[model samples]
Target: MARLYHAPLSPFCRKVRLALAEKRIEVQLIEERYWEASPDFLRRNPAAKVPVLQLDGRTMAESSAICEYLDETRADPPLMPKDPTQRLEVRRLVGWFDDKFHSEVTSKLLYERVNKKVTGQGYPDSGNVKAGSKAIKYHLDYMHWLLDHRRWLAGDVMTLADFAAAAHLSSLDYTSDVDWNRSAVVKDWYAKIKSRPAFRSILADQVPGFRPPPHYTDLDF
Candidate 1:
């Protein structure tokens, strides 16, 4: 069995988890406080990242790379599209959520409201939280636009792009930060994805000192 060192709410780790679960890979989930940077953890990942995966007698760092490696190693139930153009589109949306959305929304909101408390950094920065709250509306609108045209974020099939987007959105959803009523299309897309068996662990996540909203695990919500 593989082993994963992860932080339950970290979007990157969550992305990898979703991909692994989608591939039906069984892994031992070990919660790690990457901020503390234990010697063993640092040895596993010099970067001190939460998602250090031990699999196939090798250690892997970075969520995107790990997901790709898994996708390559486990070809069945593919997470990436076969066509080059389609694959690029999937990668684009994955980067969009992991990099752009992460910087503009997740860093501001999750970092302020949750990470700070977890890391003992300080209280939530109201300005950053406000900015994140405002920025999410634009992202939600963008998602609505995408869903209006395609069955999924990147194309007609569910791909890694959806998991990447869901990883971030689910983290925010845990905090009740997402406005599900903002766009019915986006909400419907999320409801569909969230209903997947791969999302079970994500939905069951319990961050210390933080309680999820009742609707967090509600499939109908």
Candidate 2:
């Protein structure tokens, strides 16, 4: 069995968790408060980030790398496309979500709306929340454009890219930050992904103070 050190609501951690679950890889989830920068956690990852994984007798850091490692090591239900072109597209979208979307949306909205409260960091910043609200529209439009052409974000079949995007969107959804009405295509795409078995643990997650909307767990939504 694998052991995963992760923080609830972290898109990066969720991405790795989704990949692990999708592949039917059982993992022991250890919730970590990386914000505290504990020495033990620091030894596991000097950067002091969540989603530190203990697998195959080795410790792993970095969500994208851990996910890819799982995909390569596990044969069932492949999360990455085999073709070079499609692989490139998948990686691109993964980067887009984990980096650009994270910087523009997740960090601003989820962090403000949830993380600050959890960490006792004071109230949500109005300016950051406003910016995240505005930026998500553009990202939803981008997802709409992609889904209009392809069945999934990268290509015909579901890939790591889908998990990557879903990780961020789901975190935002937890705080009711995502506007499912912005694009019908995006909403439909999310509905399909959210209904999957891999999303069960995520849907069951309960943070200390915050609560997700009812629609957050509704598959039909």
Candidate 3:
């Protein structure tokens, strides 16, 4: 069995987890305090990041790279498109969520609200919090725009792009930072993804100091 060192709320880790679960690949989940940077952990990945995956006698780093490896190795329920143009769109949206959305929203909201406390980084910055709050609305609206024209974020079929967006949104949802009412289409899209079996573990996540909203695990919500 593969083993994954990950932070529960990390979108990157969650993206890999989703890809693994969607492929029916069982992996051991080990939570790591990467911020503390244990010598043994550092030896595993010099970059010192969560989602250091141990598979097939190899240790892998970087969430995107790991996910792509899993998708290519396990073809069932593919997370990427076969067509080159569609593949480009999938990668683009994946990058949008993993990089742009992460910098603009996840880092500001979930990182400030939850990661700070978990990593002992002092209190959340009110300015950053406000900015994150505002930024999320626009992001949600953008998602609504995309969903209005397509069945999924990248195309008609679900792909890694959907997982990438869901990963970030799920992390924000954990901290009650996402405003689900802002976009009905986006909310509907989330509802579809949230109802998947792969999302169960995520919805059940419980941080020692933080509690999820009551509806976090409710399928109907």
What TM-score would each prediction reach against the true structure? 0.99, 0.98, 0.98
Runs in model 2 with CA error above 4 Å? Answer: none
Each model's C-alpha lDDT? 0.96, 0.94, 0.92
Query: How do the residues 111-206 of candidate 2 rate in per-residue lDDT, one tens digit apiece?
Result: 998999998899999999999999999999999999998999999999999999999999999999988988999999999999999999999888
Please write out the lDDT profile of model 1 over residues 43-138, one tens digit for every residue: 999999979999999999999999999999999899999999999999999999999999999999999999999999999989999999999999
Clash count per candidate: 0, 0, 0
Worst 10 residues of 3 by lDDT: 212-221
Candidate 3 residue lDDT tens string, 71-171 = 89989999999999999999999999988899999999999999999999999999999999999888898899999999999989999999999999999
Residue 213's lDDT within candidate 3 is: 91
Question: Worst 10-residue stretch by lDDT in candidate 2?
Answer: 73-82
**Cα-lDDT of candidate 3:** 0.92
C-alpha RMSD between model 2 and the true structure: 0.8
Q: Give candidate 2's TM-score.
A: 0.98
**lDDT for model 2, on a 0 to 1 scale?**
0.94
lDDT of 1 at 159: 95
